[model samples]
Target: IMLVSVTERTREIGIRLAIGALEREVLLQFLIEAMVLSSFGGLVGIALATAASLALAHAMQLPYLFNLQINLVAFFFSAALGVIFGYFPARRAARLNPIEALRHE
Candidate 1:
């Protein structure tokens, strides 16, 4: 379901590519957007996770021994996800035939 909407967004990308933007440029643009969105969502997720962890610890009567630190591993995972998800859309958009795309209604 989510991917369907993503494909719709890709249409706009196709338009951009058809207008003379290079493939690598389109990929970079999508990568940057994905990184920005992922960072914002990751922050929200980390905050919620921290709150939930604290609440669960309190409820179960555990001490503050566990830590919720944003380590290198988390950064790597988020970056990987962003790149992985953004690549296909960027590639699809970059490959659009300019003539067909321009003709699209």
Candidate 2:
């Protein structure tokens, strides 16, 4: 269900590109939006996970890695994910034929 949604959205982006939009522009637009949304969602998940982990640790009396912090690795992972995920859609958009794409609906 989710994959279908993403693909359909990507196709719309491709149509935009077919009309002379730059590949990077389309990619960046989607990537930025996705990152913004994902960041908010990830933060919420992180907070919940942190609280749950703390409670679990206390209950189970287990050792914990208490110094958890975001780092360069996390940044890189996020960027890489954005680029990697965005690349194919951007490429498809770039390859569109304006006439054919305009005919798609």
Candidate 3:
């Protein structure tokens, strides 16, 4: 997805670079974008899981335990995964040749 996004935004990125945006700036932009997307997904998943667990436990007459530590860890892992996976495409965008990218149709 990141790769496709970067591809689709080639012209925009090229314009940014042409207008003096630094590589690190472009990298950070995409990295943050990815992290935000993944973090939102993780939060939704956490909410659903918590709701389902509580509902199931109640249905079965079992104690429902909410583990903040576990959820926080999962969120951290999710964000980390985003950074790891996002780096490649972000790097590709950062390293793009502005002239060539701008020429892209």
The best candidate in terms of lDDT: 3
lDDT tens per residue, model 3, 16-103? 9999999999999999999988888899999999999999999999999999999999898888888999999999999999999999
Across residues 1-105, which tens digit of lDDT does each residue of candidate 2 receive?
223434566557656776678866765666665566555556666667678888999899997554445633454566566556655655555555656655665
What would the TM-score be for candidate 2 when compared with the true structure? 0.60
Q: Tell me the whole-model lDDT of each prediction, alpha carbons only.
A: 0.67, 0.60, 0.96
TM-score of each: 0.72, 0.60, 0.97
Task: Rate residue 17 of model 3 by lDDT.
Answer: 97
Give one digit per residue, the lDDT tens place, for model 1 in 1-105: 224434566657657776778988877777677776666667677667778888988999997454435544565677678777877766666676766666655
User: In terms of lDDT, which candidate is stronger, 1 or 3?
Assistant: 3
Error of model 1, residue 25, in angstroms = 1.0
Sorting all predicted structures by TM-score, with the top scorer first, yields 3, 1, 2
**Residue 69 miss distance in model 1 (angstroms):** 5.0
In lDDT terms, how accurate is model 1? 0.67
Candidate 2, superposed: residue stretches over 4 Å from native: 1-6, 10-15, 18-20, 61-65, 70-72
| Model 3 alpha-carbon drift over 4 Å, by segment | none
